[model samples]
Target: MSAGSPVNLVVLVEERSADEALRALLPKITPGVAFRIAPFDGKEDLLRKLPHRFREYTYYWRAVNSRVVVLVDRDDDDCLELKAQLSRMAKEAGLPAEAVLFRIVIEELEAWFLGDVPAVHAAYPRVSLDLVKRVKFREPEDVPGGAWEALEHLFQQHGYHKKGLAKMIAARDIAPHMDVENNRSQSFQVFRDGLRRLVSEEN
Candidate 1:
């Protein structure tokens, strides 16, 4: 979506955690570029409603001067297939390929927290930086079994409450401190690059 007004970025995410994380990350990367989040109830709900959302966006594409970015978790699905499905939905909605972008976090959003260990340590100082520095995390977008569990495990090792893995607080805390340019997660890099491309084109 692109109207004659300044560029507006509409990002659709899986839930509150993603929205919280983006709130922390977007300003640093796209200052002066307006952005908003449309978060659904978890991944399943997002996937179920996404095609309809894309169709809805087509109606305002020109009027709003907005661009749609769809972000999802790669939870158990084939990444390429999921992307292709989203692309198909966009085309079906009569949106030009360039009008919308789709990105998936491999295992889960927690992987992004792992991408910048320092940010994680900063968010929850109780979690020792030394431990974070020593333990290796899998790729951000595609963890094998349980990304949140892995994160919780790491926290446990470092002395955070056994059951108090606060997702939103952690995202809010870590995002502000993350080095968007040097994140260790490939998926995170791709996400940032996509936003940069959109912002550059708008400029």
Candidate 2:
């Protein structure tokens, strides 16, 4: 682990979108830790396939540097269950829990990008206004007509709701949009730089 050497990271995600979002945002969020996105087919794939994949990559990562990170999204109500399973797997593999990081956004991945009820409706128009309001906690008047239609059209064009499409869209397209909207460039840099300074001081 020499200074200036890239920190190797292993991302355990199912789709290209998650890969892209993590690749774009993680380095900005944690400087000095360069990462690469490695995809697994899906949750079922993880169950059936991850042990082999993890074994293969774990050896590779240890050879380079004993640093790695795993990220996954909890897609539905089974999120907590998934985390427990992953935790058990990590322990069995002799990896500390901190070596893996998990994030379960409270809502669909799309919510991470749009943030507000109206913005989500604008991005996804086909959903019923009532449903959108229920999810986003905003009044119907807050959403303009035609916004939902446009969003629905966008989702359809992108083939959303199809198998594995939502994750792809979130990582590749929507996350970047949210990053920019949230001024993530500045925020991430600040957090990274501050963390580095703190680490150096403690050392």
Candidate 3:
């Protein structure tokens, strides 16, 4: 938050874990900026409601001095096509492109945890960064198979969370430990940049 640039941010997240992660991460990123999380049941729900939501937000935010960031997982879709689709949705919603920002966490939110190996270590404490370092995808965010599943498998092999991953717990444990400056995921870079741009101006 820059001096005199008051911002109210509405984060439209795809999952509960995303909501939990952003709830912890955003305030650390933008101190003094007012923001709230609007979590969807999942990716499908977010896409289904996005057009209407954008239209409603356009009208409502005008009175509240606010802006919105729509966050989703790319999830096997063509990233360029997905972004263009969202742009079209916003335009059809009667909202200007400048009024809202869209960001995709490629694969899924957990890939972000893999991006910052130290954060993952800090969260789980037993997983070795060396194991994460040896994965085929150099950038974990670009992993083809579900990133969350990969993370679960890793932990499961190591005798942690044998039942299953609790997404909320994983998010809460890892997000606060993420080092913003050290993450290698391009998607994380885009998200960070988008947030900065969104809050750079006075609402």
Candidate 3 C-alpha lDDT tens digits along 84-193: 99899988988876678899888688878888888888888788877555855477776656678888887788887899988899899999998877777788878987
Give the 10-residue window scoring lowest on summed lDDT in candidate 3: 130-139
Judged by lDDT, which candidate is best?
Answer: 3
lDDT of 1 at 145: 52
Instruction: Please give the range of 10 consecutive residues that has the lowest summed lDDT in model 1.
Output: 135-144
- Ranked by lDDT, the better of candidates 1 and 3 is 3
- TM-scores of the candidates are 0.89, 0.57, 0.90
| Model 1, position 57: C-alpha lDDT score | 88
Best by TM-score: 3
Residue 111 error, candidate 2, Å:
2.4
**Deviation in Å, model 1, residue 50 alpha carbon:** 1.6
For model 1 the local lDDT of residue 117 reads 77
Give Cα distance to truth, residue 169, candidate 1, Å.
Answer: 2.3
* Tens digits of per-residue lDDT for model 1, 50-156: 87888888888777777899999887799999999889889988987777889988767788888887788787787766644443554544444566887887777
Model 2 misplaced regions, further than 4 Å: 1-6, 60-63, 116-171, 180-203
